[model samples]
Target chain A: MPVIEVTNLHKRYGDVVAVDDVSFTVEAGEIFGILGPNGAGKTTTVECVAGLRSPDRGRVSVLGLDPRRDATQLRERVGVQLQESQLPDQLRVGEALELYASFYRDPADPGELIDKLGLGEKRKTPYKKLSGGQKQRLSIALALVGNPEIAILDELTTGLDPQARRDTWALIEQVRDSGVTIVLVTHFMEEAERLCDRLAVIDRGRVVALDSPAGLVSSVAPEQRIRFRPSAPVDDRLFTDLPEVTSVQRTGGQVVVTGTGDVLHAVTSVLARNQIIAADLRLEQSTLDDAFVELTGHRPAE
Target chain B: MHAFGQILKIETRLYLRDFAAPLLTVALPLALLAVFGLIPATREPDPQFGGRSFLEYFAPSLLVITLAMSAVNILPTVLATYRERGVLRRLATTPASPAALLAAQLVIALGTILVSAVLLIAVGRLAFGVPLPRHPLGFALALVLGTAALLALGLLVAAVARTTKAAQGMAVPVFMVAMFFGGVYVPRFLLPDFLVRIGDYTPPGVQALLDAWTADAPQPLHLAIMAVIAVLAGAAAAKLFRWE
Candidate 1:
């Protein structure tokens, strides 16, 4: 069974719609990414799924329990790490994990989780005294301390340096390996591309696209661009006549072939038939950024 | 609930870790008593003070000022900071409700004030030759009512303030007004008649505490005023409290 199901979720605050018709399902043990730019209702959608906010219209199920009706039962099984949440300035690292651990019926060992998160030395340190990376790690530790079956982390790496972000990503994969369904809400295309098994690209409170990172990229722009400097002259019709080749163009002593599946193989074989070597060959594949811009009609501002 | 107790234990420890609020809340009032209590003039009974020692006149008011400091300055600011920092919202994501944290804060604030009151009374009798309240029940009743009224006002401030800095700023006028009219800053016996009249109408004002400590019974009128303030402010606070 899917660990979480959100169907036709709609939520609004006064006149402003925070989420509209947002729907997705998180399977067991998958790192399901909710990819979107800021203010795209990513947090609102997950809030409803976590039972922190009730949807105005929707059906949400987590582990076969209704998020709104079975809220207590749901909370017991779902862990959440919210964006920009803070601890008391004087609360120590171990004390925070212990406090959160006490909230669940059966919780993970606080000491073990803290050590796993690499915070053993800072167990007695106050929250305000920790660096940004340490605080972020502590927040993630609190989420998993409940030993919840599903964990939802929102904006997990928004402000971290590149190295810390990569470290957090590795930790998340380890959590998933231990049997927790992960719902990661993030706007960083690289984070989504690196960690997500399947992504629901939310744009302006709606799901614009849903697929794996590579699948979403290809769905938008499947054609690949192969560039090479040919050893001899070749006719454009030599490659265009093939089914996979869409167009062949020449640019500044180089030939650029644009086509769909197997385009590279078809062009290489044609060059070989003409006894020509394709030098300085390079293939440019479309990234998630390209797909995001194509689907959303603009770049997600970094 | 177990979660409430856990949060309370951690919160109490955290509150003590701070150098300013808790220290000043309990220590400042006791410091005043120690300084004034050591003086012989305040210890001697005199007719100008209605046959009561000058120390007795200020003892109950000292406890009232402690309540004002904690409820107005400390308690509301802590709660507002929790909401400002997203602690309350974060708690909502867990099996524990955020209301657990709010309840724990109230318990800690009241507990601190109660301890302060007890220490002030104990130290005064032991070191300064001051008598404890003659009517224990009346003193307890007035203390409860006064604390409730002040806390309700504090909760109202926390409910409406957007940030911790704003909470402290908004609580200042309430704190100052309580100090001035509650007879903590000036004795009711020494205040002008018009100002005394205003003090009589103030909620958690020290006059009831004074009446209970020195008189046979606390006046029904003072108790009724505090009860009214508690209800009105408490209702407003409950209606306006926000987690974010």
Candidate 2:
């Protein structure tokens, strides 16, 4: 059964339509990714599911409970880490965790959660004094404190340094492994490709495409590119007859060969036959980012 | 409710953490009480004014001012900041009703104002030999009315302020007018006859009525007027208060 389902959802702010006729289902125990550029209504859709904002026209269900009708029940089961959330400046980390814990019937131990998030040393520090990464980890800790069945993490690693981003990614995988269904909203293609079981790419408040990262990439551009620098310059005529070789281009002492299946075998055989010893051999597969741009006809605007 | 208790704990925790702000609110009034109370009864005597010493003149006004500082000057900024920072909205996601949050705030405001008033009166009696209130019931009634009135006005400001900064910007002008006219920094009767005549129609006038009841010569009519102002201000505040 799906943990979350939204059908024909619509939300408008004055004349601006934030979410328009969007629909998606997040299956239980799957890492579902909602990928969109900034202002693409990703947050709005999630907010409606979290019961933070009321939709004008739509139906949303989480854990078989209506988000608006059973808001309290829904909130108890789902954890959310909002974009740029803030706690009181004077509130210490430990105190904030304890306070949030009191809102739920069964919550993870504040100390244990803080320790897991690597916040034990900064437990006494006020929210305002914590660094950006520290704050993000603290927020994740708070979201997980309820021991929720489903977790929504928005803009998961927007400001984190590379090391912190990797740590966060690990933490997310750990959370998912615990059998909690995760709905991740992010603009980072690498994050979506790395973590998402399936991604629904959105544009202009609408879902443009939805599929697994690999499936989407394969659907858009299945061919691969092979590139190498020859130890000695090879004649272009030597590789012209291979059936799998779709196109070949060379510039600045580097040769790029593009083709479909078995291109590697075909190119290597042709090179060997011509006695063209190559250096710096490399093969590039189509990335999710390429598929995104291919399908949308533009880069996902961050 | 449990949520009310939580918000109360949160608000009180903040107040306790900021010792300087709350301390200044309480101490400034108490210091004035002592200074005015120590003056000799015969010094700068005024035939028309009822009090023989400054302490007798300022003690009740000090209570009104204390109420104004907490409810009017301090609360709007804090509540507005909470609204702007998403604190209130975040809490709203919990089972905690907006009523619970408001109740917690009012409880803390009353508690602080009561403590400040008690300290000021204690200093008035022990340090300056100011006589105890001749009419205890009247003093209590006036205190309740004044606190309610000020708190209601503060809520109105919070409801109207779009941002925390706007709330801060508003506090300066409202506080100055309330202090200057409400008989805290300046005695009402000392004003020119034209000003004194109109001041009674405002919060200062209502406070003066309550203070009159504090004197050996009590004025029930003045207490009645203060009660009316408190009710009106409270109604206005309740109508305008908003969470977002």
Candidate 3:
């Protein structure tokens, strides 16, 4: 059974529609991602699943229970790390973990979770004193303290440094491996591509595309590019005549081939036939970043 | 209920760590009492107080001032800061309701004010020879009712103010007005008859109940007015309070 199901959900703030006819299901033990640009209704959708906000129209269920009617029971099973929610500034890391632990019927040992999240050394540090990465890790630790069946993390690594972002991603994989279904809401394409099993690309309060990261990328632009510096000067017609090649360009003594279906194999064989060695060859596949721009008509920030 | 206890424990610890709130809510009241008690003329019985010394006449009002300052000036700011900082929003996602945190804050504030009241009464009896409340039951009822009414008003301020700075700004004028009616700056008996009558209906007017109890002539009318304010303000606060 799916761990969470949101069907035709609609939410609005005054005249502003934050989410419109949004629907998605997160299966058990999968790191399902809600990927979108800022203010794209990603957070609003998750808030409904977390029972933090009731939908204006349509239905939401978690673990087969209605999010609104069974919110108290749902809370016991679903862990949530809200996008901008925070603990008290003076609250120590260990104290925060302990306090949240007390809210659950059977909570995981906070010390163990702290160590797992790499926050053991900062256990006694107050929240305000912790660095951004440490604070994010601590929030993750608190979210996991209840030993929930499903965890909803919103904007999990929004402001973290590159190293911290990668570290958090690895931690998220470990959490998923422990049999917890995770719903990650993020705008970072790299994060969605790396961690999510399947993604729902939300744009302007609607789900524009829903598929695996590679699937989404391939759906928008399946053509791949192969760039290389040929050992000897090569004519563009030699590559253009190939069946798999769509376009060929020569820029400052380097040859670039854009094509689909065995293009790599076709290009290499053609280069070999021409008796020219292709040096510095690299295949650049389309990424979710490109797919996102194609679907949303702009980049995340734009 | 268990959540309430845990929240209260943490909130109390956090409250004590802050130096300013404790100084204003707990220490300042006692310090003021001491400073007023040291005056020779205040130690002598005065005609204005019907043979009671100034220190004796002022003890109950000082307790009211302590509770009023905490409820009006301190509680609203603390709750509003929690909302501003997203603490309440965070708790709303948990099995423990954010209402538990608000309840714990009220418990802690009332507990702190009660402790201050006890200390004031102890000092009044020991150092200044002010008699204890002749009607202890009446004094206790007055204290509880007055605290509830003032805290209700604080909750309304917290509900209306979007930020801690705004809460503090809104609270100051209310605090000054409460002090004026509770006779912190001027004796109640010295006030003109109509003004004194008007003060009798304000939330801090419970000071009249406390004074009557201390003088062994408990007035049912003052207690009735306090109970009415407590219910009305409490209802309004409950209707207005927001988690975010």
Candidate 4:
């Protein structure tokens, strides 16, 4: 059975519908990503799953128990790192972890999580004294300290630098590898494409598309654009007449061919036949960003 | 209960690190006592005080200041800061409820209040030669009721204020009202007859506490008013408090 199943969940706040008709299931041991830009109801949907908010119009089941009715039990099994939530300014990193650890029946050692999240040197540092990246890492450590079955991390890398972001991504993968299911909420297309095994793209309180990153990319765009600089002059029709080629154009010194299905091979063959070497050859396909724009009809904020 | 203990332990540690609470709870009241106690005239019994020394008569104001500062100013700011900073929101996500965190904070505040109370009484006895409350039982009862009433007022401020600055701003009127009626602003003797009557209705029941401090018993009217205010304000605070 799926570890989490959300069906037709709807919630509104004083006539403002924060979440409406959001539905998805997270399988055990997989990293499920909820990808959307800010104000897309991504956090609200996960907050419902985490038992922080009650849904107005549908059923949500986690571990075969209702999220609201079994909220206490659910909290024990579902560790949540909320978006824009924080600890006391004077609380030390190790003390914060240990305090959270004591709340659960079974818990991961604070020392282990500190080391795992690279917060060892900062164990004695007060929360307010830590850098943004260090604070983010400590919050992640607090979430995992409870030895929960599922961990929901929202906007987990919003404040980290490039290297720290990469390091955090690696740490999340390691957490997933250790037999825990993960629900990651993020807006960055690259992070979603890299970390998520499957994702549900939320936009304006609805799911635009739900599939693997590659699947979403392929479903929206099946063609590839191959760009190369030819060693010798060539006619555009030489490539355009092929079955796989849709259009051929030359920009300055470079020839660009757009086609679907084995178009790269077909273009290379045409180049060889003309005794022209394709210099600086490159092929690019539609990424998640393109898929997002195609599905939502607007570019996602970077 | 176990989770509450752990959270309480951590909150205490954080309280020490910040130390604002301890300073206000222990040092501020003692400093007030020292400044006033140094006056030779304050130690002399005067006709204005009905044959009571200033140090003896002004003793209840020390308690009033300590309680009002904790319940109205210090505690509200701390709680409001927690809400503003999302500490309560994060706690709500864990197995331990946010109620546990609030309870822990209250417990820490109560600990400081208790320590301050003990020290105040000890210093009054040893240094200034003021006797303990004439009716110890009445004094203890007033202390409990006064604390509950003042803390209820503080919680209401904590519930309503959105930021620490707002909490401080909001607390001013409340703390001032408490101080005014508690006779910190104007001593009960100097106040008009009608105003002294109004003090009986206000929370912290400072007149009742003073009566219990030097007389046989606190007024029953003051205890009843404190109980009613505690329940009503506490209910309102519970209704209005926001986790985030």
Q: Pairs clashing in candidate 3?
A: none
| Candidate 1 residue runs with Cα over 4 Å from true position | A231-238, A248-253, B186-190
lDDT tens digits, residue span A61-148, model 4: 9999988889888888988888888778888888888899999889999998899889899989989899888888888888898888
**Best-matching candidate per TM-score:** 4
Residue A114, candidate 2: alpha-carbon lDDT? 92
Q: Best-fitting candidate, measured by DockQ?
A: 1
**Best-to-worst ranking by DockQ:** 1, 4, 3, 2
TM-score of each: 0.96, 0.91, 0.95, 0.97
Query: Which residue pairs of candidate 4 clash?
Result: none
Error of 3 at A56 (Å): 2.4
lDDT digits (tens) for residues A1-302 of candidate 1: 68888899999999999998988888998999999888899999988888888899989988999888898988888899999999998999999999999999999999999999999999999999998889999999988999999999999998999999999999999999999999999999999999999999999889999999999999997879999998988888898899998988888999999999988898899899899999999998889999999988888768
* Global CA lDDT computed for model 3: 0.87
Local accuracy by lDDT, each model: 0.90, 0.79, 0.87, 0.88
> TM-score for model 4?
0.97
Task: Report chain B TM per candidate.
Answer: 0.97, 0.86, 0.94, 0.93
Better of 3 and 4 by DockQ: 4
Docking quality tier of candidate 4?
Answer: high
* Candidate 3 residue lDDT tens string, A132-242: 899999888878888999999999998899999999999999999999999999999889999999999998899999999989988897889999999998888888999
Interface RMSD of 3: 0.9
